[model samples]
Target: MRAFRVLSHAVLAVTALLAAAVPASAKGEDGAPTEAGTTFRTATAVKQGQKATASASAGDYLYWQFPAGAGQRPTATATVNLADVSARHGAATWRLDVFDGLRRRQPCASGEPEKKAGQQDSSVTLTCTLRTVRPWAERWSDDPLPGAYYLRLTVADGPEEDLGLPVRAEVEATAGDAGGAHAGGGELGAPLHAGAVAEPKDGWTGGWWSDRWLWTGGGALLAALAGIGGYTLTRHPHRFRSRPGAG
Candidate 1:
């Protein structure tokens, strides 16, 4: 009985520790982290066909990072939910710029244009698309490179004080069936970027793995099960013993 009680207490303590270590969801400004190599804050990862939300004021610059596979093209669309005070500032123009992993501005094949937010408009959407990711070679020149890409959003005209507006960003990457003839080399052989492999700080790196609550919960459950199994096997050792020489 004493052994059982001690084992139960150990399991409970370990479970509690695991639960405490799990990170919680961040809210408001806390959810965003400062982008590496830049002062802009980064929100949660905007997966393909999924939307991620962030808050920013007028004239505030926002940045987001997304991954692109070789022979794949990525498209990002951002919609700004302006506050009521934004209407007083008249029409507002917003710009979305796409950059490669090296922070070099890459030209978009389509959807790279300034969007105007009128006084009556409650929201404005801007989209930017990049060509297929390809290697740099003599055959294919000046093409957009693959790997990680960054999108920068800025409001050119708006009320300066009207900050804290909500913005939704949606990103999508489409992969081709096979490599094109003109697509210089093969897939991206090198690493995506230095930032891609960096460990996330406070679960707010804005990558797909930022949300670790599910993983941690699963781990805790597994640990509890293992502990129970160990205790049962040890406590019931006689059950496994051959009884009366019966096989």
Candidate 2:
């Protein structure tokens, strides 16, 4: 009996330590590091290739953010479990919006950014596949640049009763480098992110020169050659000769 008690206590102690080591948020069916933020500033940060999940009311907004480097295209896919089907009275629309670190909404290169789930359906999935992250882009352009990107998932329209009901959301964030073809030549004046930014592994340098500069230089050279030819053809031919055969 004494030996059995000692073994039992040791097992209990080890189990207690293991449970304490795991974060409370990770107790979900699928381990989630943290809860989704309600706003951009409070957005939960997820690492590249990592998945983030949260549970919130159907009416509440869920936000997650991930970092992307130049030359890589970032895509965010979210699966949302609507309120209990029995409580839902009608169809609901869910939207997934992606934004750069600057908070400018990024366009989805693929299909629609929203999905409609029927009242009988328990869940819906939405995805936002963004353009390739460019090394450098014009100031006025909203192109996806190297920096942090945010994901916002919210229920657009739903049954009145289901609005405040509990729901769960899961977001999978991934960034894949598309190679040099997608990267722009001109470097952005500044990264979209404020603090430490993710950069390409090979190295990224911008603001030096781009295809625009090359085009401009080529056009100028062609114009100069054209002007010189026109002058030569229209000018007095005898000006270069020695007085019409005196030579």
Candidate 3:
């Protein structure tokens, strides 16, 4: 009986560890590390519900990734160096999002995340604060679902320079869950290829700007021609007069 009791206790401990392994976000000591590091990038000038671009007027973005069914969350801390602030630039804000492959999940509130092992729901943890030296350090966390996940970062408008903002994201996770393996495969949450435009903002593009310029230039040229014709007719009365005065 004692031997059976010992085995049961061991099983319970292992279960408890596994239960806590998956988190919305976790620290380095708690998660797993991959040989292939996980990370992504974006612009600080990114606005809500808008795609990011590497435009001078825009800012910078950074993201982190985790493998599907790894049985752990991906979290990281990075340093952000801000410089060349613009008068129009607003406060530098940091954000986090979870993605199955490339499809981002909606922000989950406390105690309302997807189920993992023993927990009824998962969780998301984030910490953002400012630092001196024009550079800030940010730490992020997320309790990920049993599929591929990504952590995304954004700044309203970043500093000025190539590699303008020094942003680095480190990842950690815990692995091993036979149930997760049966839940689904890695293909479920696949990342989209480059050049995949999810959606555009305000229904405008570079082509639209070019067309506007063409129309404006054409209109100005037509107006100038009309004005010249009117002036000539008014200044030279004989030009339009009947030559012999018979008609």
**Candidate 1 per-residue lDDT over residues 1-247, each given as its tens digit:** 9999999999999999999998655433533332212232342343344345555566667676666655455677777777674335577788888776667787777884479888788778888777766544333455565456677877876655444455443333333322343344344455345344222221111223312446667889999999998998899988777889686
Q: Model 2: which residue pairs collide? A: 136-188
lDDT of 3: 0.34
Clash count in backbone of candidate 2:
1
Better of 1 and 3 by lDDT: 1
Candidate 1 TM-score versus the reference: 0.56
The segments of candidate 3 whose C-alpha lies over 4 angstroms from its true place after superposition are: 1-58, 68-90, 106-145, 157-247
Error of 1 at 99 (Å): 0.6
> After best superposition, candidate 3 residue 179: deviation in angstroms?
12
lDDT of 3 at 239: 84
Specify the highest-lDDT model's number. Answer: 2
Displacement of the residue 212 alpha carbon in candidate 1, Å: 40
Instruction: List the global CA lDDT of all models.
Output: 0.58, 0.77, 0.34
Question: How good is model 2 by TM-score?
Answer: 0.67
Per residue, candidate 2 scores C-alpha lDDT tens digits across 1-247 of: 9999999999999999999998666434544444888999878777677677787998898888877776777788999877777777899899999988889998899856898999889889998889888877777878888777888999898767777888888888887766544546566555668333344343333224345556778899999999987798679655655775674
21: Cα error in model 2, Å: 20
The candidate that achieves the highest TM-score relative to the unseen native structure: 2
lDDT of 2 at 83: 76
